[model samples]
Target: MVESLPQTRSVSAEAAAENRAWVSDLSSTGDRRELASRRLYDVLLRAARSEAGRRAARLRLAGPELDDIAHQAAADALLAICGKVETFRGDCKFTTWAYKFVIFDVGAKVNRHFWQRAGVAFDEEDWERLPARLGVGPEAHAESRDLMAAVRRAVDETLTAKQRTVFVALVLNGMPTDVLAEQLGATQNAIYKTMFDARRKLRTALIAAGYLQEHQPA
Candidate 1:
């Protein structure tokens, strides 16, 4: 319909059925957009609250904080839904598609919640503690200690400061990229790429140091 009539008309029977389903909701009332917008926001709010509740127990956030997260997620989801309403092709139910964005918003907020409570240090002092993660069997322990030492030297010597922070916080501290980006006021894509590049550098370092093989099998 939007200058892509052929693709729309030739869509699979399943997509045609989905198109029909989209109509039923759109044509339900005369004040269609108004009613639909209200309904969409309400449903999004419920979905956001559902996700927030699931995370709050584990994170131990207070009631007010949980409510705030849900509301913020709902607000963001409403904008997403409204902005993309015209693009809905009913590939899935309206509710299902709408729920996905709310979940995304809620998940990001929950990840950021982790950083708000505490900060992870990715410094030389912390790297010295990395050997603890490699555990207890005297023979294997010796190998672990050696590997940790190599890793420490490789990380400190080979990587730049920014790469070290991204690599250490992500790999060692187990912080998700989204949480790190939010805490640092950066983009998720940028952090992920930095981590990827850092990983490549680390692998190259390990292989060169004889700690890892040049070619690893799947």
Candidate 2:
């Protein structure tokens, strides 16, 4: 009775009934579940396509690429929805809850697609441009030279090879973490961890060298 009260208070009767119907259809065996799955995928595909189209310009993707991302998102979202359907509590209509999965998948897939399409290449020339990339103007180079030199020294002296690569690619080169992850054949979390360790080491070195105060942000 208490559980029923919560559902009644939170979900309209129509929404609750619709949610139950969706759950039942999805949970059924054989033909019924197959048909329901197809319908749900179609709904998710349309939503993903809309989102992909909207993001096409920013992602530098054309129609075929956008359609590919949309299809991948919809397929992944369907698997996610099926796996997590038991977590649904009828707080809203089932379709609404399901659409959230598609939206999230679209975002992740889009990031992956963008990173794969846009390469992050780091070279010695890019290394030399660090001062410019960090917004240290030529006029201010003399004033900021010590700080930049300290950062370079710290990076070379304090960090491991992998950490240095991740730091240079992600921080100095303005490469997206996803792009770095793809290039390095690593996970984004792993790339982030490497960057974190690199920053911590650099912060310690700069603080010790008197270039950065202990209170300054890393």
Candidate 3:
């Protein structure tokens, strides 16, 4: 015959008191702190991942490089969080601050990749020379497949042949002034003059063709 199992007793008052005390101690220090830290980690990780994905999509990065970029961005975000942990005043949410770090890290990574691929040197001289090389402002010309043709026509109709060649060599081809001078068998000063004349003529042509507007005489 099978024996009957003994019934379990309810928790005694003393045991319950000890359990409550243990729980209170844990809540006062370890458990609460662990919960807070876990929350912060979760929020930061989520923000970093979101920013990484957004940047990758914006830059149209594909394959393993995209993953590497995102990983690097996440690592940067975590490092920033650790460095600024002392300054977390709890005024705003930690996630909000983390999001800014994540975005900045991802943007910086993307810029570095693009600059490297394009062979752009980041210096004051390079910055100043950029407009002469890349043309005017960001939206200086309309986006079209026939943009080069239109630009050529504008140059031919407005500028002399030598000025047009100088403009193309220096601006579109990213040739240095010294190199352009050597190629054209002219002095750097002469190249500069040709570029200036080409710019003026092109501006006039653009304004006349309604591609650009004339500024109020100032």
lDDT (CA) for every model shown? 0.68, 0.74, 0.56
Tens digits of per-residue lDDT, candidate 2, 1-218, equal 01331265667888887787777777777898899899999999999999888756654577787898899999999988887776678788788888898887777676555445434443445456665554444654565657677777887789997886777656654567886787678999999889888888887887798765677656
Return the clash pairs for model 1, or none: none
User: Candidate 1 residues 1-218, lDDT tens each?
Assistant: 22111225445666656545444444455676567667767888888888899866645675888889999999898778767656766555667777889998998887666445544334554554554432222433357657677877877898887887776666665677777887778899999888778777777776787666556310
Evaluate model 2: give its lDDT: 0.74
Better of 2 and 3 by lDDT: 2
The prediction achieving the highest TM-score against the true structure is: 2
Can you tell me which runs of candidate 1 are displaced by over 4 Å?
1-32, 119-183, 187-218
By lDDT, the candidates rank as: 2, 1, 3
- Ranked by TM-score from best down, the candidates are 2, 1, 3
Each prediction's TM-score against the native?
A: 0.52, 0.59, 0.41
What is the C-alpha lDDT profile of model 3 across 1-218, one tens digit per residue?
11222222444455444433323332344666456545545565566566667655434566777667766777677666656554543333345555787777766666555423433223343334434343544464344323344555776677776775676556643556775675566899998988887777777765665555587110
Model 2 off-target regions past 4 Å? 1-6, 119-189, 193-218
Give candidate 1's total backbone clashes: 0
Q: Provide the lDDT at 217 for model 2.
A: 54
Model 3 regions lying over 4 Å from their true place? 1-45, 118-218
Q: Model 1's lDDT to the true fold?
A: 0.68
